[model samples]
Target: MGAPAAAPFPWREVMEFGLGRLGWPPDVFWTASPHEIIAASEAFRTAPAGEAPARGVLDALMRDHPDDSGEAAEA
Candidate 1:
């Protein structure tokens, strides 16, 4: 078999767009980790009506995937 295909969704861009809809500024995105971005996207997907985007999920992701000198996090 060859290498795995890329994800169908453009996760980073999709995440960024979600954050934008949540009233977050662009600078917040530029400085955020992938974990934070993904978490925010997920939170948005599952949030109740009239609720704001959450950072609690982002905290969980950070604990699971820490920064490693520019290395990708392991599954």
Candidate 2:
């Protein structure tokens, strides 16, 4: 067989997450890269009952792995 067919892009689902679930403005949604959106979407959809990270964990993570925007995407 030739190479397996490529997976379809999940455009509608991604748009709904950005525009509806996350309530990002149209301009923000349109401008966000796929990686940025995926990171935000994952952060928002994680189980609410999960134990919260200790204070400053997020800051340390950002300092260590800053995004292209110079900060982590706000979920």
Candidate 3:
């Protein structure tokens, strides 16, 4: 038999994983949507060592456009 298929990452789990690395609380990270998680992850990945975006911008975009697919959000 071939190997079993890998499970997809759950939205909350992925968000928590990304946020945990940044020292955020579970409750805060879990409340974010998948798009938010993706955007946050990308931002962290692209940011310079001391140049992360403001939390307010991340929080606002996440709250205002929770349903965004992350394409428009990135632009």
Candidate 4:
């Protein structure tokens, strides 16, 4: 047989699994509003792998989510 069909990215399952590992209430995570989820995911993705802050990622995220005036507010 050729390469097996690639598995789909089970986003919900992955998010739940990660939250469970961190001792967070997985059910509560599932119930989060879309905006809240987006914000949280952006923060998580930008955070450094270790304790260090990922300033670059944070800056990029903020830059991307600028206000209607086309300028990002100071954090």
TM-score of each: 0.43, 0.59, 0.43, 0.38
The most accurate candidate by TM-score is 2
Model 3 per-residue lDDT tens digits across residues 34-73: 7977788788788787766699987787777877675455
Pick by lDDT: 3 or 4, better one:
3
Please give, for residues 1-63, the per-residue lDDT of candidate 1 as tens digits. Answer: 999988696866655575667667777766878788778778868878796546887667766
For candidate 4, write residues 1-75 as lDDT tens digits. Answer: 799999997886658644764445867776777687667667778866678447997678778887658765786
| Native RMSD of candidate 4 (Å) | 8.2
lDDT of 3 at 35: 90
Against the reference, the lDDT scores of all candidates come to 0.71, 0.84, 0.72, 0.70
Residue-pair clashes per prediction, in order, are 0, 0, 0, 0
* Model 3, global lDDT: 0.72
Candidate 2 lDDT score at position 26: 97
Candidate achieving higher TM-score, 1 or 2: 2
Question: Which is the winner by lDDT between candidate 1 and candidate 3?
Answer: 3
| lDDT of residue 34 for candidate 3 | 70
**What lDDT does model 4 reach?**
0.70
- lDDT (tens digit, per residue) of candidate 2 on 1-72: 799999999999988999998899999999999899989978877857568767688777767777866755
* Model number with the top lDDT: 2
